[model samples]
Target chain A: MVGPHHAIKWLVFALCLTIGSAHAADPEALDREIDQLKSDVAALSQTLFDIEESVLHPADTQVAVFLALKDKEGLELDSIELYLDGSPVSSHLYTDRERESLRQGGIQRLYIGNLPHGGHQLKAVLTARSANERFIRREVRHQFRKRPGESRIQMTLDASAPDYEPVVSFQEWK
Target chain B: MQGLNNRMTFKRWALAVLFSAAGVSAYAQTGHPELDRGLAQFALGAGNGALALRYTQNAETEQDYLLRAKALLKTGGQSEAVRLLDALIEGDYYRGEAAFLKSSLVSNDQEERRRLLQIAAQKGHGEVKQQASYQLAEMARTNGRPDTAGKILASMDTGYWAALGYMNIAADYGSRDLNPSRALISLRVAMAMAEEDPNKERGEALKAQLLVRAGLLAYESEDYDKAITFLEKVRLDSYSTPQGLYLHGLALTGKGKHRDAMQSWHRAKKYPLAFSGVAESWLGTGRGYDLTGYLGQAGEAFLSASATYESERVTLRKLADMVREKGAYAALLADAGETRAEWFLADSRMLTQPRSAYLLRFMENAGNQAAVHRVKELDSMLARMERQEHTLKVLTSVLDERLANSASDNKPALGHVRTEIESISARLIAARQNATPGSSSVETIRHLAQTLKDLETSTDRFDKRLHKRDQRLRVLHQKASDALEKLDHRKRKATDVLRKANAALDQKFLAYIDQESERMLVALERAEQQIAHLYEYLALQNLGGGSQ
Candidate 1:
């Protein structure tokens, strides 16, 4: 004998009670949902970053320079300055790992940048201390044609010859 | 110019020998004053360029060509030097000096150099002949022709040069070949020849240097007693370099004389040689105490040494910067009060490709706090599920057992029997209440009472069935308890592995910090020493006009 208004009220009360019960069944559900949302956002952000990097630095125009030592015992490298086409590009003071790598006949990637295809002059200025405690500064220059692809330059300090002074040389990667 | 002077001096000496052989006593009257001045300048190791220029302009003798050749070599004119040396080699005078110089210059052509050295050895005079013979022997030895080397050495005349040659050979034998026994024999021969040399003071000085070399060789060869014997004979003031002191310390340490070793190391640290940093590092770390424990002091000494060398200092500084940066990040993570995921997110944002992999691994494994908590939650949930499953299984088995007992015993089902019993009890109570003392319904009441008693017996039978079911359920619960116990043990083992993995990661991080910092410190110290040495070298050059 309930009126339509009273029946609608009862229906609304029932719906609210059911919804409250469902929510109360698992209190940590909201927290888990929030964590999932955060994880998704982070993953999306990382993907975007990767895409940006790939779009910004493509392969063809990239140029890289590597430095190495033939014999580390005879010379203690202090610092090195690199110049491309008469403009300074990179200057680095050596780190222990870098020095150790050189001593162990390993090479370090010293500089990376982009360059247009053409001839370029690269210069490396190296400062080092000799085994006899003498400070020595050496400058080496090389002219290379960076064709329509990536260019790689390798600068090496060779101290293998016993009777001669240490020599620095440059080579281009094909 | 020095070459010219040396050849001129050799010519004068040869002339004197010839005059004496001819029984001429007035040879000094023929001596040239200009030649004497050149000889004096050559002896002082000065003005060789001017002397060579003068000789080139005059061009009077074979010695002048030799001097010009030497000057060309000094001035980086190697091709011109070689031509002049070839001319001298074909000439009559200064052939040995020219051949020796050519041998040094044409090192790539070993066979020709050896042949030239042979000619010099056969025809050269005084020290020149002795040096040529020694070099030929060295060449033979290096070519793996030991017999030829021995023969060459045997043919050499005993003199100051011969003594020096023996010492040089001994040094090669001991250091390069690791033949200490053979080196000792050569050293003994050199000592005997040195004692017999005409220049007593010079011979003794050379012998002392030889003794120091022998001591070090013996130390290297691990002949401690022999090393001590040789080292004791070394003259400290003239021959005690930092290396010598360091070696002496090692020898003392080998002999279990720690106090003496410490004393030697202390003295070694006072010198500004290359080994001084090593000595300081050793002393700073309590002479081989655990380096990990004394990292700060050890790093300081190492960095100090690194600073002495320009290249090494730069390297050390870079290493230090990297370590400092990484260490600060690690410290931040360690002190962070936030959840592991939050920390990881912040830390990973600053990481590059390969480094970011560490965070990914931590996030995946139970190595991080968040991951561990997640694992623990899963483990707890699994345990609860297992408990509920066990309870359900026990309940199902009890119900099945009750049904089987009811069927085998030909008894009524438990639910039907209980319902009947309740109905009978209610009827008996109603009938008793309705029956009066003289009423006709007394018989009906008595029948109801009998039905109630029978129902009570049926209820007791149901109780027995229920007791058997309870016993079976108890057995199943016991089995479940045993299974849960095994599960708990396995969980504990897995947790232990996780803990160990976390500990290993921490240890790796700590070790990276410690080792890189130590290396940076040592390199810094070495660079500082090298800079100081460079400065000292420059100052000395300014004061003395050239490197000593």
Candidate 2:
């Protein structure tokens, strides 16, 4: 360690064109503390993520809605709004990054919240820019029975062959 | 800042360019939608690799294997990913993608990587083909076979990828063919392509590299004005800026603006010596001082640079020792305080690590940054595992308390749900006694109640939500069908991910980071040599000037 005495000696060189590498010299004694926590962190991250989810929304009543835009070539999704049981729960304006990811078959979890067990209506309202350069608005609603223990519904927006009009369809995962 | 400019994939480039709408949807729908969802999670990068990997463990079809391979690419190592892709190499389905991904996985094996890349370039559709061609051409150009690279480059798409092709051509002309004028022209074309790219950050980085190359070429040709024009346009934050500054200073010296030249060289010297032009910048700085008649200061500056490089050599040795003993984490956390699995607290926590400023230049390699992020993620996962273990312990005690209180205390929570379960069971029993067709219902009830009872003795007893028998009965009726089993699966899956991440850290990340550190040490040694030469020159100059 350079104390006050030797510090002055450093500047006696007249010109110092140097970006000095200075830090508290990390020694070997403390290496174990971090090494013990290594690889353990990735597991803890996943655990905490799962723990946080379970704590916030237990699996028994958890309802997660996902969105997928599979028809990347025919339609450009500008924005989409989702409603659970007739109340707006999620809305997203698609960035080019997200949109392209979706085109490559990436499904996004749009909303994850609790729902009491029973039947509910999921309404999707979206405006997409189609090939004609016109903003086409579409509204679709589906009735779904929310089974106990983590109901995951993936709503896929696609364009049917020939006509290429936008269509929104829903699939539930076990 | 820009994370990985040089290695921007075709898909990354498309992130900014607004598409001019296609006629039809090109997405191929797989029968299993769950795999698509997993693919989505994989696309997000980090933290979700486990989720994607675990969910797709039982991948069957060619498509499934490919998706699982993609998940493994992020979460696991190269060998398993290669094994998975090997299945689809002969199959018609996803042959191109599988080949391209395999090429990426086996990138260390040059022969195999080129072979796979060639396959992908020939058979792959869309972005994969363009990217494979780009890689193949880049490799060929790097190997000094510009003619072969140019032939291969013709197959690549002429959008944003054209910029990279021109970059390869410029590289070829500059070094391989020794055609300065052709190299400058190629670089100009590359810069023009950068302008057309909608990805502004990537464009800036592309142009920066091109400008530096052109500046150097122009300066070498003694076209000081042309060099000045190209170098001045470089973005200050670009990775190539130090190199640009070095050449710009040289161009200024060519034009006899010694003071302005000194300022540029001084700015360049502020960068890490490991950077491409920083060593030359040090010599330039010393020369600028000599040119300006500060002979003593010139000697001092050279001496300072020499001492710094020699000290850097010592630091590199220490860094290597640190890595060997403590792994890459210690050196990375040199600037960090209280750094035990803390990067998980925030994804970007590693940004402030590595107290040595020059270490960041090594980390700027996309591969190194990814490895660092992976290490931090592993730390986060480990921390979470501890939390879960604690949670499991708490749940155990709570279950014990619930059992202890079961004899006397009966706090009615969700009583109606319990009554509903009791009523359903009673009705089922009555139907069974009367010999009715209710076998499945009766058996499911028995299965649920028995499983919950058995798990009561296990470490991971159900949470407080199922504390009371009535609540247990309610949950048993509601989720006991698969809840207990899935919870167990999840705990096991987390362990698997941790094991995989640990192996990956050792297999891929640790070795790569060490290699990068060694590379930095080599660069530092080169810088040291340049400084020594400059110091000798300056000392002689001072002596001659003093004699005059």
Candidate 3:
């Protein structure tokens, strides 16, 4: 009969070899799985961010300020409250609501007289209260000027995100 | 036989003498045809043929009696004049004046009046002809035939006579129905005649006065241009009274040279309304200083303008407006009394909340009240304007809706669609069978469509350009960032290299400079020592030489 010690050593050697191979393979496989997971996580995070931006932002974050003088139509709107450097311009604001508030955004309609042929602007924060639970918010720094007659204002927004498309827009009476 | 015949002849002669005396007495006592008839009846009643014959002879000899009869008839003694005229016509004497005068006095009974006027016209005498025309005009007036009277008056040729007849005819029309043109023509002719001949038997001054009257009549008749010409003719520059100045200013203002008008007004302003101040102001001069736009001066002007007029008068509105337009602070402040305040408040109220006089119950009761009168008239005008505005809005909207609905409904042949397209041309052609005139619906639609197409094309082009620009900018930005990073790296390497080169060069050059400086110092020191020795030797030599 072969010697038991030799047999045991051989078996042990095999066991050691298998365990060593497993150990080597385990670390490599775990590293590869971790790398895959990191890529997937990055992709998922980007997708989530894009979805949130589209759903919540509703508008471009970087707004271009403009000055505009709408025809008499501008005056007929529900309220035209202009805030300049966080203060109300008396000429543009119907009336000051309170010290705490810069202007009364939802004041009654103003009867603005005929607008002389010229351009004007108001840098402002616009808040449109909705019939629903959500409040529409716009941080606008609009910069537009009027011409002699009827003219259209085309606004464009710039942003840094890769998937974000710069939005262009205009306003018209309904 | 001789005694009887002679006695009878004596009786006849005596009877004839007695009848002649009675006839003479009767003719002396009587006056006209009636007097002659009475004398004849007296002679006949006395049973004396010789007396009757004598009375007839006596009546024939009385020329003054016939003249008295003509005078009575000519003076519109209608019955007496007609009786005398008839009796005179029966006679073989000339009776033109009596026939004419009697015929001119016929009553309004058309047949009789025409017969009388015709007879008078037949005479061909100028005065008789005028009287005939006058009678005809009277008939016309009495018969409600003023237009006929005007026509007749217009046709008359002789200036003075025609003018006289026209004046009478115009009077028949009364002031309300008066044809001022006819009146003016007549007056002008009369005036010229009076001015030229002025019947110097009457007076030249009277003629001039007549001219003035004619000019005033023309001026009041709304013939402003003619008034100007006529008044200027009579105007004497030397005459400086309010009336003269007023007329002068009126003429100038009517001519519409406002500056000259203002000058006249200014000169005339020294006079009050009772003195002609109003006419001056209307010509637009001599208003208050307050009305002049000079703040300090306007106060005085406004005060004067206001003071010149009656305080309770409605004309104060014009003065108030003048002061307001002057924009003088003091003038406005001073003018804002209770009355002015009420006016302002009323105006403000009207401006803020428009009143519809038609809807107000008080309006019906306001027959003569000032505000009521004004509001009623103004409300009607405003209502008409509002109606026009509403109509325009409706028309424009209808056109718009027609166009929109047409485009959506795909009805290409719709009248409104055609109208919409036609509107762009602004040529208000009458609408075709189905089209409304002045509606350019078709043209409008075509223009809008073209504009929308252009917008689409432009938007696409703009989008492409912007996208390209954005991409180019981003790329350029990235390249700049990379170039900056490379430059930073190159700067670091150059700085390190430069620092090492500078350190080395500094050490070498500094050491060399120091060494050169040290060598010079040492050489100088040695040379100095050598020089000192030489000098000492020389000194010794010199001393030895000096000692020698």
Candidate 4:
């Protein structure tokens, strides 16, 4: 036993409730705005990085070194000290969490700097522990000629099986 | 209808990005074993797949190809994964794994999967021989032959994991599937095999878990002595320690050692309540105390258990509400040290996450994990596209400036030269009309030469205005403008879709939170009931003592 006027009023009330609830529950509007700004800011960084590379270290003189830990090497990295052209350029001490992250396997950029197009030396001193809790320290030096465009070195900490001795090797990426 | 269109657009955009990213750069395989590994572990090892794929896009090695195939599957490119796997299989690199994975992906037909599984089982390559054999055994079981399943499991080729699987199935038989002796025998075999697993930390952890499982099965069958022997050897640091201690307490109670049972339950209750038997251990402590004629202490123990559960319930509700309010993308990152990097593992700080156990359990579901991952990927893609958009804007501006300098700067001078050429042609036609046929031919020739010299002098001043350079600049400008327009349009569409997708993911996260909230409530209610019953018993005991 409802009148048409009352029915209309009820429908209007329900519509308002729906709109109000939707608005109240929606945090995505603010999030969306913030993300858009972040995206816009990120856009500026791409060009900024490109400009930084050309302006700071021109391609002809740029040298980049990358590092990676061998997968399932049965050894834990402790620390690394790196030298480029007899100058200390980079060093890192690995925490347990950092070591765990590295265990999942990905290349980490060690250093990037300007070196003239000619022969340059990269020296690394690494300290790591084997599965048997044996502490090992190793030092290795590599010499490579920088090319016209860009020079990149991929450094790896590997282990030989059975005794699982830690070995550090460097390869120039082509 | 609008949502559908946006989804389709997003899918097309995602496909384009993946396919284009698949265009690998040429690089000679460095022959380093490290080159074979990638963040591909992120796909299966709780890392990011697209990020991993990005770093390894220039892979040249067959092993790298296998890694990419796995990564592609994680990123929803199943067909692409299948194609890569097929190539690897044909080339005789990881043929077993490739065949098994591709067969699973490329068809829904059971017959086809079985055939490929058979191929994988017989193949010599790939590290999934045990997994493939297990699948075959499972398929046989599904076809209603339990005997055949057991036989298949028993006949798997000899390896650490393979032999362990055989022993595991035998242990399964010990659970009323076969004689109790067989179960005990198989569990002993599994225990021995697990000790030989090469993985150091994981091997030790698994061995401890195996002992707990064996002890539980034994305790279930009223073999208290055997159960105590197995449970006593469990490492305190192992994940199963709570369950082990709880079961050990029960075994002690069966032997009528009330004090020993209480001590074991006391140790078990010290662990996180998220542990399977930790809450039950609390109740067991109360029950032990009541049996030992310490009814007052028993009542206190039950009250303590109830309070602990109620506290956890409050924390769970607060966390769930936060997830619902902030949306999943941000809430997910807040639990672990307020940084995305902290997600590699849970932070142990109580202040940072009061309910890390429950949250970790929630993330164990693959769907919930994917919900978070999808939002992350979308945000990353949007940021990348935004960066490209800015770079394109700079490019367009540079091109426009060059076009202006090279062409627009000389536009007026070129126009004047065109007018001069027209005027000279008109004058020459007038002279031709005025002249008699042959008279003064030398004079006419001299006049024409002077006019040509004048034209040459004027045109020489404007020599920098090369038509070819102008045309090139104009074409470059037009192309850059067109590219800018298309990218802008796509970015707008992508922004809209990513926002909506993010909101949808948030709802999924909220759903998980709701489910966990319900579980916490149930546990809290059970604890409250136990506390009330314990208090009632204590009151009845006091009343009987007074009457006596």
Candidate 5:
């Protein structure tokens, strides 16, 4: 093992290299980083494959979707705010005011009759945490419908793809 | 550090043997030595199939074969897995686990389904145990061992196993069209267990199936109320299964709700073959239209039904007796015929009542027929005697009523009235005796007439005093009312005393008539005796001895 003095020297060298090269690195260093990324991707693929491989066919674990509705309107009105994990999946603009009830606390709730499938919102409240960082408190509010035969129901919230990965893993009971 | 070194050494030894099994050709397939080594490592991790195939086609590497055998199941080689498990069992290495897994994958037969279930019960994980038990129950039912299925299901106590078991039993009962009570009991037990097991998915489906079946059984038993209740429960739960809807339709039809029944039947068009063809034929024959629509539509429906019914020879034969009776009032008849067995079972006693009475009267008047026939070659003595006896009974009852009225009338002589009634009754009894010598009813009539004659004499004498007493009471009431206006005068005092005297005198006259009471008591006793005699005569007629 290297002594603490050697580790400190290496750390300083890494910092100096980062500050000097910044956006322009040597080809050798670039190649090393590319190789490292390739290895990381392959490792990730293997880990996923291994986890999937562990389960026997006719698996004990099943993925299920609970399609719940609070108050659904059918074929009468269109467009309602939707919430997923307590955060709004849409811009805070009200499209159907007759259905959207506004309370005194600046909180908006939609009385949705039905949702169209695919590319919809999970109506939620966006609370500002600070000037730079905003915190989203989300609730699973509505599931929109799509024209029959759509494959996936995409919840289009400001949160990035990494935030809603858990839903894809579930297999609906039907 | 020593342990890590040892583990690495073991892994390296394993990897080297596996890599060398690929032979020189596979080695040359990868250009660089480092890349070849990586490929070899990936191949080792590629699972038993890669190792075994590499070993078989290239080098005869025993290490690759050994590892291949250990992980054979990972490659979907179930038979190979079983073989390896057999070898492991012989070697006593993971014997139980290997044997259990091998049994599970290696068999699809029902017997194997049962055996695996038993093994699961003995040594399986929680979910495995539950699933295996359910599978075994289904296998048992398929193999015609419902009792075995029931016992296994009972032992399960909860979850999908119990629900499936109950559902199977219900189906078995439905198939045989017998032992519905037993089937219902099993289904209810299953439903109860399922309700307690919150995570069980089969609960709702099984409950719906059981309810539909129970409703049908009740319908068959003619318990319309219960059938409606169970079937309505299924519908309220939004159970739209073909059989459930069909039975709901049947129950509605039973309750005479033909409009609703038609709606249900229309929905049941999805399962054409599920119902008996007779029901389909009934529907086709305009039964629904007859109930709810224009007569023109009904005729069309019937015509279509007849065509369809005739097309299927087997169904035609089964339903020939049913649909041939169709008309405006045919539904009532069909309903009656269906419940005929129930009616016979229920009113067997009441049906015997009038049957015995008619038979008795016939035999009493026809008992001498054989004797007369023996005397004449061509004759109906019984018919002649029956006619005579019937004529006499009619004459006797008419004359008796007439004589009774005349006796009660103050203008008619009591002796003449009595004479007329007695002579008519005597003639009727003599006629009955001549028809059937030993008939008890003839003697009973004679005794009744004598008692009535005695009652008539006493009634006439009592009526004389009663009429006089009534007249006196009416006069005394008038006197009492008149004396109220003259209460202070001597005339009022005199009238009051006279009214009291008149009331006492009327009471004395009524008390003197003991003969009327004695005659009524005697007449009533005779009437009771005549009723008893009639019952005995009826009994004799039923047994075919009244003619004698």
Candidate 6:
């Protein structure tokens, strides 16, 4: 049996030791937890950014031109040259598959590019062989406005005219 | 004595005239015996063999040999005809005509045909040359080289045959090339040539046919005004077929004359022909109805047409069955080589039956669906895979970029840093555990506690950030998964709708057939009963006739 004052002093010393050990453990454990959390956050952010990049396009102004031939008869297409404001943008000598696809009523994407929003001119020169085996050249020019968003120009080979020669016409898709 | 001398001179002159006339008649007979024999056999309506024999027997000229070859060909002696034509071609006087005739006999060799036609056109005389040129132009038109045909026709002499050739070329261009304007030009030239030709009745008939053809071509080319003009010029009395009437209606419809168009269709339907069904379908679909959006009237019209076809088919089948039951009649028809009539009857019955026609149309629809169903299914599956793949690719890139950034930062990897921090923690714990209550300074304890508190606060902040990002990621993953589920649901629903629609169509077709078959059976029973009663009455009358 001990005296009351001596017992209280012993209790206080025990409590202090327990508190000191607890404090010592807390910092090291917290540091490890924080390092893990930081790593996780960085990884998640990167994942989110990559997802956005893949699914979304970068903000830009662009114009696309599509070409098609309707009633492509009596005309054997050889090549097509696309021009933007009097400057050549795309020149393609048609491959067999491409020509066949066009003849089968497939649309070809002639050009796609970023352009400042304003009025623009497009010109396309078509070269083909006629039924008489003579080389025929035709050119079509069209004026269009490129708005803030994407603009589409469609070039059609219309051969329903009286002469049965392919008539190239450009129309803006609204 | 002078009167007697005058009488004798008159008698002598009469005798001389009589002998001269007899000699002239004899010369006419022997001089062109081949022509006379050919004409006589033709007049008697003799068979080709008899005509050929006569011409061959009397072959004294190049013309006679040509006529014999023509007769041989008519008699189906193609080899003998070709041999005779070869012989005739060796003679310069008959070469062109012989070559022209041979061209008609040959088949399956376009080059040879063209060469022969060219030779005939270039060297044949008079009408034969013109006819050969016409044939060459026609051949070119048939070969899908309309421009060549046009050129050939243009080079021909101005005549009725040339005009006919132009008309044929115009018809070819109209039907094949779908160039009505060019066709119209050709027609105008043909019409002018016909007007100038001496055969008035034939020229008028040709003009009428050309006008009708021009109208149809104009309608096809969507030149409705021109079509109306040309169609109006067509004499309805002789040139108006059901097809013509329908085309006229179409032109009228194009010109905004709806009432007139309806009149034309009604007139067309009155013909009771195959095209009448088509006209009815068009009228039902076009007038006062949206064909695409509202299919009720169109369906009714199609059902009606189908019923008509089914009835016709059943009637023909019954007739064929009746004919088969009469074996004697069938054998007689077979022996006569008239089995084509039986076949035609059978075909007519099948096609005209409404139930059969409906089933045919339904089967056609089913076939079309089957053709595209697999393609659609595959496309749906591919799209789903593409979406999933894209999501995974994005996730992979995100992870890759994070790793790259970490490496480029020249900082320790998260795992390594974690290990370092843990090691530091262990060392600190060891140090804390080793601390002697009397030896450790208060300052060292306080600094250690502050560092611990700071790390805890930083760790709490980092954990909050991580929790936020993790929640975002979970939401995105859920969204992608939900989108995939929705797409799958949509695909299933679309497939179900297609299946149900097809099933409904099949059910309708079956119901129609059952109803039509029942009605036909009832009618057949009534007809059999009536026939049996009539036969009994006739037998009784025949038995009682002598006593009465």
Clash totals, every prediction: 32, 21, 28, 2, 24, 12
Strongest candidate by DockQ = 2
Residue range B460-512, candidate 2, lDDT tens digits: 22335445454543332333223334445545655544443334333343454
Model 5 has a DockQ score of 0.00
Q: Score every model by TM-score.
A: 0.34, 0.57, 0.26, 0.65, 0.33, 0.37
lDDT, candidate 3, residue B335? 34
When sorted by TM-score, best at the front, the candidate numbers are 4, 2, 6, 1, 5, 3
The alpha-carbon lDDT assigned to residue A138 of candidate 6 equals 88
User: Candidate 5 at B489: error in angstroms?
Assistant: 99
Residue lDDT tens for model 4, A1-174: 999999999999999999776434344453444345443333333233443343355444578787777745678888888898899999988766556766767566567788754467899988888877789888899977665545778887777666778877787876
**Candidate 4, DockQ to 2 decimals?**
0.07
How does model 6 score on DockQ? 0.01
Q: Which DockQ values do the candidates obtain, in the order shown?
A: 0.01, 0.08, 0.00, 0.07, 0.00, 0.01
Q: Give the least accurate 10-residue stretch of model 4 chain B, judged by summed lDDT.
A: B24-33
Question: Each candidate's lDDT (Cα)?
Answer: 0.57, 0.63, 0.39, 0.66, 0.43, 0.56
Model 6 regions lying over 4 Å from their true place: A1-174, B1-48, B125-127, B142-145, B157-164, B171-179, B191-209, B275-310, B313-548
What would the per-residue lDDT of candidate 3 be over residues A1-174, giving only the tens digit for each residue?
779999999999999998765433332233233233223322222222222222222221211222222121112112234443445542233222211111212111111112222234534443333223234345555433332222323222222233222222434211
TM-score of chain A of each: 0.66, 0.75, 0.25, 0.74, 0.22, 0.62
What interface RMSD do all candidates show, one decimal each?
44.2, 12.7, 63.1, 14.2, 56.8, 44.9
Off by over 4 Å in 5: A1-174, B1-76, B84-101, B104-115, B138-148, B173-179, B194-202, B235-240, B269-285, B291-294, B300-548
Instruction: Give a tens-digit lDDT track for model 1, residues B73-133.
Output: 5434566567667767766777888888888766688899888898788768877788889
Q: Which RMSD values do the candidates have, in order? A: 44.5, 15.4, 56.2, 15.9, 54.5, 43.4
Report fnat for all candidates as fractions from 0 to 1: 0.00, 0.11, 0.00, 0.06, 0.00, 0.01
Superposed by TM-score, candidate 5 places the C-alpha of residue B548 at a distance from the truth, in angstroms, of: 48
lDDT of 3 at B333: 23
lDDT of 3 by residue, B183-291 (tens): 5655555555444332342323333334444555556665566666655554332222344445555556555554565565666555434222233353244222213
